[model samples]
Target: MNSAPTNYKAARRDPHAVGTDSGKSTRGEVSLSSPDAMACLRRIAWLLFFTALTALGGVRPNSLQPPQQLIASYNDEQSATLRWEAVPGARLYRFQISEQRDFTTIRTDALLLPSKSWIRATIAGLEPGKMYWWRVQAIGNSGESAWSLPVRLSTNGEMVGVPVERLPADRSVLAFCSVLRFSWRACDGATSYRLQLSPSPTFDRQVIERESVEPYAEVVELVGGRGYYWRVQARRGSESGQWSPVQQFTLLSLANIADAAPSVKESQRLRLLKSDDPVPVELVPNPVADVLTVRTPPLHEGGSITLFDVVGRQMLRMPVAGVEQAQIPVGQLPAGSYTIVITTSQYQWVGTVEVLR
Candidate 1:
């Protein structure tokens, strides 16, 4: 160690001091006060300031890329596995599934960590046999990325359920018409439905057979004054459900209905031949005690009148036949406001009636 190390610390403290043994002035040597050194220090200070700003949320990276290749890897009756390709620089992922195409009603929304390139999530408690749409997005320090394109999936399985009839009640008489519409309640796990109409209750003589993805179907060119039978069956993949209970309906013709009603006046029957006019109906005795007289325009095709209580319970239904005036017995009904519905093959009218004491 000899005469001790040169005092570099003293030289640094004294800016004008000469470098020991080097025989150079300190100004020429690299030091904290030098131009180059000051420039480097300034750069370091700016970097530290920016780092602090980033920590305080003043700066962030660019938006992440959206996830892609979304698919339903596995699906069953009540659960499904959703998978997608990972996005670069994504710190987290967001996945969503909905029964609606617009995603208005979300079924599942989850946040997942981005630990692998292939991201997968298993969602349970899904409705069986229903269709669903799913999408994904990536989230990083910058912000969330745009939503990926939606993918469609169905949970149709091995088992299918029977469909229950909804409209055109069994054993009911329908007005004479060329077309009839039939509807049924939705069935679980059904991808398609089959409808069969027959002249016989046994369905041995099929008049029309239709396959549809919807729950309702329209059959045209039906014959009047005849009875028909209809049934529905649900199918999912290769599985077929049992046929629904057979239902029957009768289409009543004008002559058949006229034979069942009281005779109408000749003047009223002449109205049926006149040019089109707004259907006019009259109720006699604003509040009747024994019977209510309903005078209607001539019904050449016949019609029916249905009475309902305030709670929507059916009280009576009578055929209008070809008569312009018919009597309804309301003495036995309760003294409350009632609803009268007049139904014809082509038109229907609704009005209110007050039954007073």
Candidate 2:
């Protein structure tokens, strides 16, 4: 009976049993399907996946760098120098100049050292009175940096000699109805000149004439017996640098021609009795066939008369007197409209006349 009891306890705690009272089992019989064990395995799997995602997020795709600094300085009136701070790992530096604010390839490019920090280059052939902009760009193996701020500079105009020596001499006056010949020494870099002639030394009224790159200009078709003043200025395209000292010249009297052509038959010619005074005028036989006649009140001595076409072309010039009548020849003139001008040294009278065939 005691042996049988022992057999029952042995069966309850068998070492090779599928399930045991002591909760100890063999490897194949172990209950690994418990909720707590399953939950622990899932947590391990999630940790491994999270670690892989974090490593990928931390890796940088590409590197980004900053732009370099630019500096510009003017060496002289016609020259400029450009410099820039060196950028580490830069392939090359591109320099650009532009007349406009926006940078473009149309502007001149000055290539600088790829890795060097300092570069000096002279900018020549620039126009005066013009503003220019410059900037630098840094290029590297990774990518190109942003462009630097633009630097602005202006060039000076061409220098001109002082006291413009080539100007016409003082008291050197030109005469009306005379071909005025003007010549002067060229300035150092002057390509051409702008010639202006007027009736006053101050150049209030200007007659413009342009000459070639040469230093001379011929002014013909001057109004006879009229006092005219003139001045000259130098130019290089839109740049009008400096004006010469105002030169004063009084147009010579029309009567001067009488000395040379005394043989020409002279009838009653119009003349201004006043040298530089205003006078009223009246015309008779204005539409006459053969002779045109004009009459004016007695005038001061030294007055003159001038005849011109509609286009201001001088046709005839004569002296004036306190005479009863002045006669003009119309036989040789073509049928058209003409202007009869009577002027004194200080006064002027203008009238229109029609010529009839």
Candidate 3:
């Protein structure tokens, strides 16, 4: 039989310490049935269970949430800005850029410390005209989170001499009209042009498309009360150049002219009129040559009269100065249909006039 432990205090503190009393195991052995010994064994078993659960994919706080809303915008032909929503409690972030969607190879791998709700990363040294993929991962005290969904972006191609839009200025607002005009500078070596209009900036869906030899085009009967985006592409034979930068405009209904026009007195003779309402202005000589005359009812306040070509390029602008009649010289202009915009203190009018040689 083994003797009783000599160091009772030490044995109570650590059951394993009881195996050797006075530095010799032959002196005494601890009783496993002791309350302290049983408590120590339970703690060891609990630690083992917890570690096994962790290795089996438990206690994953990072995987429950990750960065989101990844968006990329080109800063130039060789660089871009990547941004995304930050994850709460994230201490650091890992962002990667890759040429392959599956991320077989990484072009950029970087780490960042969380600072705000939105995180921004600027990446450079990219090749033009190539598509790239990017994603982000958040890391916290627990572990690293799953990667965010990737976003794809393309760099601008060789569009050095591409056409530039001239008319229907970007982000312009216009009143309700059946016809929409567009114009762009002519591109060299281009035999034809393609004009496209869409409700999306990405041009995923096009509502209007026209092919023309000239640099200008027109679309009619586009519904008002919405916004539209347009771009132009130059083509020569079978070759085509990249699309020009997009331009956007919003069209409002004539009844809501207050939004498009300056505020005017309600009692003025040139009161705001509905789209179907007729204006009191008239143009003499349907196909005008040399000189065109605009006749209208007497106006209490002066307004401006303007002429626009098929491409919505302004050809003439003059103040009516409260006059009932105004004359415009069309002899120097090219033969085509032009739009006339008459704006008074209280009303606005849009009409088409045919100019002759």
Candidate 4:
């Protein structure tokens, strides 16, 4: 009795194209040449189609399946890795890890990994003797899913092999418009460095690996809106030293690039420490542009002082042993915040230092 709705889809016309309702035949017939003029009739046809299909029942939602078989890895010095069995129909996964059982002391942020096959995330800069925890969740076009049961991780063993520093200074987000330059500190007694990058922190998917002896490398093809984990190891003759810490960084698109320099958001969580642990030694010239002097207590006098860019890229390493206080040259360093981890036989402490040019 009435004209058809103007919402029906046409094979060629835009979905929202409007249709006229002024034409009608005495026999109650309608002629709709345009797509939108046949919405009601198309709906009736779809109803009949889906109705028949509905009689056959339906499939389960994709979000119902969760990632399983979660595993932790400690393959490199100062690093932790989480791997899990991929969930079917999952387009992305969220991986989180923390030192606290309550999830209040997380070190890494939610890592959104694309691909149903992505199943791992590796993080570096883990101090020895600390208990860590981690979990994962799957995401799809449907929605985010329930988080998996958390798991605890125990330290494997004391770090060994000559330590090389990873760069882009960990967690360094780059603009997609710029070429990504990966660098690390050169290791003594090493002939080359192996650089590895991946969409999944575990290097399970979309992996890129390269080898160089210059202590630095570059890449030109990482897309925006995804997290990447990278690491480096020094190779000498038949021996490869322990890998530098794993670093996670994001590449952003052009819209986010307001200025010539890419926008960088540095995330350095509060220094993780036990309640009764000794506070780290004081460092003079914290907002220091040049030289930095560390006043160490007797307990940490002989410990090593190491500085890392956020996301765990080591920037500087020096022995603070046999001295009341240690001073290191930072005259040529760029302006930014850095983390300092002081390690001795007894305990380890972390703090932050800022550099200004």
What's the TM-score of every candidate structure? 0.37, 0.29, 0.32, 0.30
Q: Against the hidden true structure, what lDDT does model 4 obtain?
A: 0.57
Report the C-alpha lDDT of model 4 over 1-357, residue by residue, as the tens digit: 022232221121112111223244222134557544455555575467446535655323444566777755454435544567767655456565677877874444443444334355545445556777877777655555677888876554533255454445455444353456665566543546678899887888888988775667777667866778988887643346676667787665555443332112243223454335466567787789756777767544456666666555554555556566666555444678877776665656676788898
Cα-based lDDT at residue 192, candidate 2: 57
Over 4 Å off in model 1, which ranges?
1-158, 259-357
lDDT of each: 0.63, 0.53, 0.64, 0.57
- Candidate 2 lDDT by residue in tens digits, 51-166: 55356553221232434444434444555555556667654455566788786422354334443444444454455578878776665455456777777756655454422544
Clashes of each: 0, 12, 1, 2
Name the weakest run of 10 consecutive residues (lDDT summed) in model 2.
Answer: 1-10
User: Clash pairs of candidate 3?
Assistant: 302-322
Candidate 3: stretches off by over 4 Å: 1-64, 158-357
The TM-score measured for candidate 4 stands at 0.30
Ranking by lDDT: 3, 1, 4, 2
Q: Relative to the unseen true structure, what is the C-alpha lDDT of residue 347 in candidate 1, on a scale of 0 to 100?
A: 53
Candidate number achieving the greatest TM-score relative to the actual structure:
1
* Candidate 1 local lDDT, 1-357, one digit each (tens): 112221111112212222223344422243344555544654575478457646856544346778877755334566556667778777666677778888986655555666455776655555666888988877666666889888886776656778874456565565554556677788865657888889998877756888876787778867867888888998764456899888777767646644443223443332231124465877776566546677877655558766666766555456666778766656545688877766666556666777887
Candidate 3 has an lDDT of: 0.64
